[model samples]
Target chain A: MSEILKMAWRNIWRNRRRTLITASSVLFAVFFAIVMRSMQLGTYSNMTANVVGAYTGYAQVQAQGYWDDKTLDNSLDWTPQAEQAVLAHPRVVGLVPRFDSFALAASDSSSKGVGVVGVLPATEDSMSRLSDKLLEGRLPAPTAAEVLVAERLAVFLKIGLGDTLALIGMGYQGISAVGEYPVVGIVRLPSPQLNASLVYTSLENAQELFAAEGRLTSVVLTLDDPDFAEPTCAELAASLPEGLVALPWQELMPELVQQIESDQASGFLILGILYVIVGFGIFGTLLMMLAERRREMGVMMAVGMGRRALATMVGAEMVLLGTLGTLAGMAAAFPMVLYLHHNPILLEGEMAQAMLNLGVEPIVPFALEPGFFVWQGLLVAALVAVASLHPLLSILKLNVINALRA
Target chain B: MNVIEIENLSKEYQTPAAKVRAVDGVSLRFERGEFAAIVGPSGSGKTTLLNLLGGLDQATAGSIRIAGTDLASLRPGQLIDFRKDNIGFVFQSYNLIPVLTALENVEFVMQLQGRPKAERRARAVELLEAVGLGERLDSRPGQLSGGQQQRVAVARALASKPQFVLADEPTANLDSRSALTLLEIMERLNREEGATFIFSTHDPRVVAKARRVIWLEDGKVVSDKTQEPTI
Candidate 1:
């Protein structure tokens, strides 16, 4: 085996140009797969951070039947005891109670349906980065009845800071209710859907407008360890009162998980195509090499080398080439992926807004997971190994006398 | 003791046009330490007879026994092992692997026999030096002249110190001077080292130097002659 390996190594280097061309193809394929996968994963991470962490926190606690029905009757009573129980968990970093309702806002001839979230001013300030996201005016006062609307919604309404807007919706008892509140601030969210239709107000004003005192839609919880969210939520669910349930952020925004999974699956398909192209490139070069070394193979066989030994030598050459190429590709991809992970490429123009509307961040970053790189490297090695079987099988059928003649 | 025994050996190759009988109803024997030659024209089955005797090709209907073992009865893997262990081959084309240096090429057979590196290297160097290729040990076959390359092939065949060596027109590609030199070296080895040498060739010089000659024509042995007893 050692002799065969040594001979195989020397044979590969005999034609330096051919070896290099084949190796480079494999390297480029591996590099492309790694970088593309990293970027796709990074984009997904960024989207999850922007949409989940910035808005919904990592997990939420709601009334047992709230998510399915989402009616005013299913709202939880925000009791001090329940709040203290949730907040005292070791993993819980912050918690905020929210009151949510659907309403219509009309300004002049334009009207739009909006999701209105009523939050405590001090709690919202501490739990979310919404205050920093404000583009105009100031955060509404804790005791005031003023509201904050998204910048895009404000534009469509032709409304500015300090402008009075009429909000009309069904109140807690299912009665038709109306309120006049001033738009105290305008904010921008990364998601176009949220930016176009979301409005925020104080908890007191929400209770007054909706006639729903002490009723809250959900309680959002942030965790110091994002990955612990699901398990912690499960634990909370087990310990919570019979009428309450805990839901992770992924369950709240299932589309995000589905999109990421589908994107990765499609990316893998693309990577497979890339490997095919690289395989063909390497196979072509190897075939040419085998053709050129016909006499050499014949000589070895004529000199008492068994057919299996010759095939083994050929296979060993391919494995060596694959290993080196994969290593080179990894070396190149590491820094490239790392650089992109930190500094993502931001999309602009209509496409940017279009992506934002779909709840994806405009910037596409690169991410690295140890498993992803290992799988990619193994995939490349396996492709090369498969490609090498051609020469191995051919050598078995090779006629020693004919090869000698050649 | 007879090293190679052939009994009613016949070899036939199937071609698209017809079945070509390369060796028909041939029987011969080679004793240990004997230098013999099988001389014939092209397509006269001399090489075919050598192939059968060396266990490289099977006889269509015959038996071949080398050193008391029936070559025809061995399995495929056993045949390969038999060839590697007991038989050595020297082709007209020298057949040295181009990528291997002369020393490495000679060491290849020993490596196959599972010989240690140190011993294989020592034997390879000794054989190469005996063949006057000591200085050219590191040079590849492509770098050597036809004669030097053939010398390396001879060294490689003898590297494993097999029981018998088969040479099929070993001098066919060389000039007269190199041919004589190669034959002389092989003849001397046969005499001094007790190694059996068999040649299948039409080269008159090679035939003249053989102690025994089997003459074949049209796939049949026409004459079996032992040279006039030398004084």
Candidate 2:
């Protein structure tokens, strides 16, 4: 076996140019797979961070029917004990309770329907970083009749800072609700749909105006690890009071999940095509090598080498080539991918603006996790192994007399 | 004692035009330590006969016994093993493995036979030295001259210490000087090691060196005779 291996090693170098070219094919395959897959996953990761971090915290807890009906009638009771019960779980790092309802707002001659959300200013700022998004003024004060209107909403109502805006809506139990509040700030919400008609005010003021004190439409939980969101949601669902259910961000924002999955399927299609191309390249090399050495193989067999032994030598040659190329590719790609992971490519001009309008960051990041590196390496190795089978079977079925004559 | 016995050996090839019998109704026997040559024109079955005797090809309708073991009775794998242990082959093209050094080429068959590393290495060196390639042990076939490569092939054939060595047009590709040198070395090895040798050739130089010669015409032996070797 050692002699066979030594011969195989020497044989590959007999045609150094061919060996290197074949190996480079595998190298390019692994390099492209790693880089392409990293960029795709990294983009999705950034999008999820933006959407979940800015809007739906990693998971949410709401009254069982609140997500479906979304009315004051289905609001969950928000007491000190309820807050403590949620915060006691180790995975739940922070909780922000929100009283959400719809109302009609008007400033002079302009009127539009809007989603009115009341939040504890400090917790909302910590979870959603709402203050960072403020285009003007400050957060609405807890006890004052102040509000932050979304940028688009502010434009539609033609309302500016310190200007009073009138709101009217149905409160809990079908009671009539009305309020007049000063616009404290204009916040830029990333999502175009949310930016169009959303308003923010203090929980105390919203409950007072809606006549639903101590009731919150949902409690968004900031988790320590987003990857564990599903398990945490399961535990929260089981432990929370009756009529409350925990929902992971996937359920809260299914459109984002579907988008990632759909994009990922297309990415795999492209990757599969790349592998097929590399597979053919490797197979072509094997075919040429076999054709060139047919007579030498016949001589070896006539001198007493078995068919299986000859095949094993060729197999070893292919595997060695695969390993050499895979390692070289990884060595070349990892540093580049890691660099991109840290220093993402930021977009500019119209592309950046288009992404921002859709609430997505325009930077492209690469993921440097070792899982993908190892996976791409193994995939190329499998392709090489599969390509080598042709040579093995050809040798096994060889006609030594014909080969000798050739 | 007979090392090889054959009776009515025949081989047929089905070509598009017709079925051609390459070796037909040929009976031959070889004794231990004999240097014999089969001489025939092109298409007269000299190579086909050598191939059958070396177990490199199967006879269509005949029996071949090497050292009392019937060739027809051995399975394919067993025949391959038998060839490995008992028959050595030298080709017309000096078909030494191009990647291997001359010494490693010689050691290859012994290694396949699972000989100990030390024993095979020592034997390979001895054979290469006996073939007058003592100074070229590390030379790959590509680096060697035609005569040197054929010498390496001869050493490799004898590396397993097989019962006999079969040479199929072994000197056909060599110039007169290289061919004569190769024949001399083979003759000296056959005498010194008592290794039986059989050659299939149209080369009169090879016929001159053989102690016994057989002539084939149209796949049948036309004449057989024993004579004093010219060498």
Residues A160-262, candidate 1: write the lDDT tens digits.
9888878999989797769889999999877777889988999878877888988899988878888788899888876677788889987988887888789
Error of 1 at A126 (Å): 6.0
CAPRI-style docking class of model 1 based on DockQ: medium
Candidate 2 C-alpha error for residue A137, in Å: 1.6
Q: DockQ of each model against the real complex?
A: 0.56, 0.78
lDDT of each: 0.85, 0.90
What stretches of model 2 exceed 4 Å from their correct place? A78-91, A142-145, A234-242
lDDT comparing candidate 2 with the true structure? 0.90
In the order shown, the chain A TM-scores of the predictions are: 0.82, 0.93
In candidate 1, the residue pairs with backbone N, CA or C atoms under 3 Å apart (3 or more residues apart, or in different chains) clash, namely: A38-A367
